[model samples]
Target chain A: MEIASFLIVFFMVRYIRTSLQTAVRFPEWERILVIVQYAASGLLAADVFLDSSITKWLWHLLLLGMVGAAYLLKDFRPVRNVWLAVGPYILVSLFKDIAKLIDSDFYESISTVVEIAEIFTLVWLIATWVSTQRQQKALEKERLKRLQEEEQSRIIAGQNVMLEQLVAERTAELTRQKEELEQTLTELKATQDQLIQREKMASLGELTAGIAHEIQNPLNFVNNFSEVSVELIEELKEERRREDRDIELEEELLTDLTQNLQKITHHGKRADSIVKGMLQHSRTSTPQREPTDLNNLADEYLRLAYHGLRASDKSFNATLIMDFDEHLGKVSVVPQDMGRVLLNLFTNAFYATEQKRKTGLAGYQPTVQVSTKRLSDEQIEIRVRDNGCGIPKTVLTKIYQPFFTTKPTGQGTGLGLSLSYDIVTKGHGGELTVETEEGEFTEFIIQLPT
Target chain B: MKVLVVDDETDVQILFEQRFRREIRAGELIFAFAHSGEKALAYLNEHPSEYVLILSDINMPGMSGLELLRLIKTTYPAPPPVVMMITAYGDSESHDQAMQLGADAFLTKPLDFNNLKEKLKSAL
Candidate 1:
């Protein structure tokens, strides 16, 4: 009976030790279960080779260790799972107690029941072991799946870092290109300014011939008046030299001489002014601001440009039509630059009219008109119009481009309008625009901000 | 002799009066002045045969001396007046054109009054 009980106790201890080992997280409890199994094996050896008293002591020690193992296992997992081992342990104890209580006749029947209970305990151990094995296999597969997911995440993180580096490199390259383009734009602006200065100087050269002719008109008056003054002085001297001078004749001669001297002085000053005007036109100094009357400026340029044309082609002439704004106030402008722009516009207007006159169309009196207006408190407008060969549609857009000319090769430098446009718009923050018809007229409008 | 001088310069009136002062005062030559070609033509139309000689500046605005000469020679109702074309331009082209237009003489500006007097004497 003791051997049978020992066998059941030993298997129970072995089964729990094996099951607890699979719960490796609780290694201390598995260690306790191993000690319990060792105690049961020692008790089995005592039951087989030692005296009954020593065997009984070993049996009690084994039971004490089993109790401690059961308590430790219960603390690790579900208390209900503990009952699988505890219930069999209690049944084995009951079978040991009943085996002692049963008589010879009753023992035969009870022993069969005890054998069946032992077989049931063995089957329970086998079933629990199989389920533990399956649980361990599932846990192993989950661990492998987690490792693969972690590796995939690491690869994705590395790709993200590479993409960030690529974006940084492209941004640096774009920044370099942007700086280069800005430098190019600055260089273009400087070259444009140089070209504008050259064009202004070229126009001054073209005006030199016209300026010479204009000076001739005033010089003619000066020379004639001075020569007449010399004759008047001689006539007075002759009157004075007479033995008895006629008072009335002497007074009259003296009066004529005085008048002649005054005329000479006046015409000399006029010649001086014309020279001064020419000097102003040809000046290459930087622009200086002054208050200027547009009406007076326009009127003066109109004649200057006309004389310029007439001097070149003696027969060329036009009817000058001008209407100026009486209420237009003096505008602040760079006088020399503004004067050049006005001269260019007036020259163009007269040229157009002269060309129209050459066509010899009957009743065609060539007319060039200029008008000035105070368009608003912030703006002043000057319009120069000519009834002449109008600008063609195709070349209208290109008119403001540098070196674009419609005139015969030697006649036009082609920088007049382009330079004028820059002076008005960039220099003064103004706008230059044109309106034209194919055969009727061309009007250039300059809008200046006050 | 009645002389009509046409020029845009107002100073010409005084200059002519002073230059021909003796002839004017003695009444050997009577002087009248017009500032433009149109005025000169109007003066002629108003007093027919009053002016025997016309001295005109060729470059006057509105109507040039050449145009005035052509009009006086071909269009005037009375016997054609003797016309002289005067200009600042002393080019041969202008002198020839003025001569072809029936001008009695062509004169350049800063006019040589002595030469003018000689030409005037011969033409008269």
Candidate 2:
């Protein structure tokens, strides 16, 4: 039992030291308590050899002091309970010592009861110490979990920063691409406008030759008729001043003067219309579409083209047949561009007939016919047909190709049909098609969607 | 004496009739008009030797005044009518070409009618 008590005191020393390390602040005092417990254990071992009453008394008193020292460590409930387990044992031993001195018989019975009580208190102290250890372990696990959670949050913060940077870079690149695309579209539109302008200027060059020639006649008539009218006025004045005024001759002179003035007025109007036509032909084209009367447009251009050809080549004559749909109301088109297309087609038709005329085909009257028709509610078609030297089958397919011309050098730019094709097909979303026979006739048709 | 005026402008006929009214009315000068070189040639075909002098415009639709001059001077029968080339072009090029084509005179428009009358009188 004493050995068992010594082993329990040894375990108590270790358990109290660990448990008290957390609860107690005084290290030197805890050291002293540990020494005291060790001394108590030694004394319990000494009791097996020592037979003297004084020695027995000394061992028990030292054991009693060790338990009393543990009471100072009240932070541990088990240490506090150690006093309960050992108290009566110490008292019973002290009484037994006194009984030995006085020679009494009651000591054995009382010691047994105190010893059992001491064992019960020891069991309760050990249970409390074990439970305290489990509590400390749970606290250690909670601290470790908190450390791992902080590390994960730190890593997440770093990833979020990188993700935001990536998004910013991608957004900047997309913005750059959008800006580049807008710039390219602007450049492309500018280039398209330039090409159309160039083609317009080229056709204007063709019209200039005829204009110079045609303008001469009206101007000549205006001058000559007015000059002759001035002479008639001088004659009428002479007749009025005569002694016997010739009324019949004076009236005839006045009538001739009136006729000459009318001719002057007629020629002046002709000049005005020619200048207006030239202005319209040379007008810069706007890219936007607007409402336009197709019949009026065709008629105006056909006259210009014919007069132009007449002025340049006096022998070039054609029977112009216009079959315009009177009910063909205003259609949406880029007026300048569409006008250019019509002029190009008219100039070509006239050229074709003139070529056949030059061949001196007997009884061949050069004829060019332009007709417009409304095919449906959504579509309109214009056909320019010529009974002249038609497109040879070999060169027919290549007519729309840029820089291709069957006409003599310095006469055709070869851009006319190609540009006209582009204006009809791409600009207006229409189709340009040609029907031809080698030496019979050629007809160009323009189909448009309303 | 009869003079034929060959030009593409029909107005030339009216102008000549009015401008030379005194001479025409007196029958001292007779004027005939043809609107084109082709018509002038046709007129000549009908009356080959009646016309004493011809006044022609250089630029006409069929058979230019220069070509007509060439035909009249070379192809037509003897006693050709006097051919004067009147044109809007005063350029030395057409003048030289007309002269080469045997044009009796080259005149520029707007015609100096007074100068034309003097030249016409001299040619006749």
Best by TM-score: 1
Give the CAPRI rating of model 2: acceptable
True contacts kept of each: 0.12, 0.40
lDDT of 2 at A433: 98
- In model 1, the runs with Cα more than 4 Å from the true position are A1-187, A322-331, A371-383, A390-438, A442-450, B26-32, B37-44, B47-54, B69-83, B89-107
In the range A223-308, model 2's lDDT, one tens digit per residue, is 88988887888888888899999899998898898899999998998788767667776777445688888887787677668767
TM-score of chain B of each: 0.94, 0.95
DockQ of 2: 0.24
Best by DockQ: 1
Instruction: Find the 10 residues in a row with the least total lDDT in model 2 chain A.
Output: A84-93
Clashing pairs in 2: A314-B61, A315-B61
The C-alpha TM-scores of every prediction are: 0.65, 0.57
Compose the digit string of candidate 1's lDDT tens values, residues A317-368.
6767789999889999887778888889988888887777778888887788
For model 2 the TM-score comes to 0.57
